[model samples]
Target: ILHPISVLEEEDDEAVIEKYSGSCLAGVSPKLPPLPPKILVEKVAPAPVLLSMEDEEVVRAVVSGSIPSYSLE
Candidate 1:
């Protein structure tokens, strides 16, 4: 969203620079709308738990290509 005037000025293209150089000669630029408000978030921690022997067996089976690994619950 950069003004073409700024870019042309940087490139030193003075030929077309005179056209956009005047603001008071043309008219005032329109004001842009304000941005949305910032959102606040709270940190969360997962519950602590231990995996059963069956769970371990399922993991091993999946690793060994005996079963496909997917969500259990």
Candidate 2:
């Protein structure tokens, strides 16, 4: 046995949008103006420093002490 085949019709698609979604749409934006003065004068400070210290070098000094040297005094 045999069966029949189907086919589709074709034409110019220049007006597909107008037929489905109506006419075209568009938008626009405004321009920007100049800004006013914000500052009058400027002053900047200096940076700081940090140090790690040892107590014997800055506060006191050790010459020699092992076996009762202070008893001689």
Question: For model 1, how does the per-residue alpha-carbon lDDT over 23-66 read when each residue is reduced to its tens digit?
Answer: 44345577899999989888688888788999889888889988
Deviation in Å, model 1, residue 68 alpha carbon: 3.8
Poorest lDDT segment (10 consecutive residues) of candidate 2: 1-10
Which stretches of candidate 2 lie above 4 Å from their native place? 1-12, 17-27, 38-40, 47-73
Candidate 2 local lDDT, 1-73, one digit each (tens): 2222223245335444334443323344566687987887677676755434663333233334433435435
TM-score of 2: 0.25
Question: Where is the poorest 10-residue window by lDDT in model 1?
Answer: 1-10
TM per prediction:
0.36, 0.25
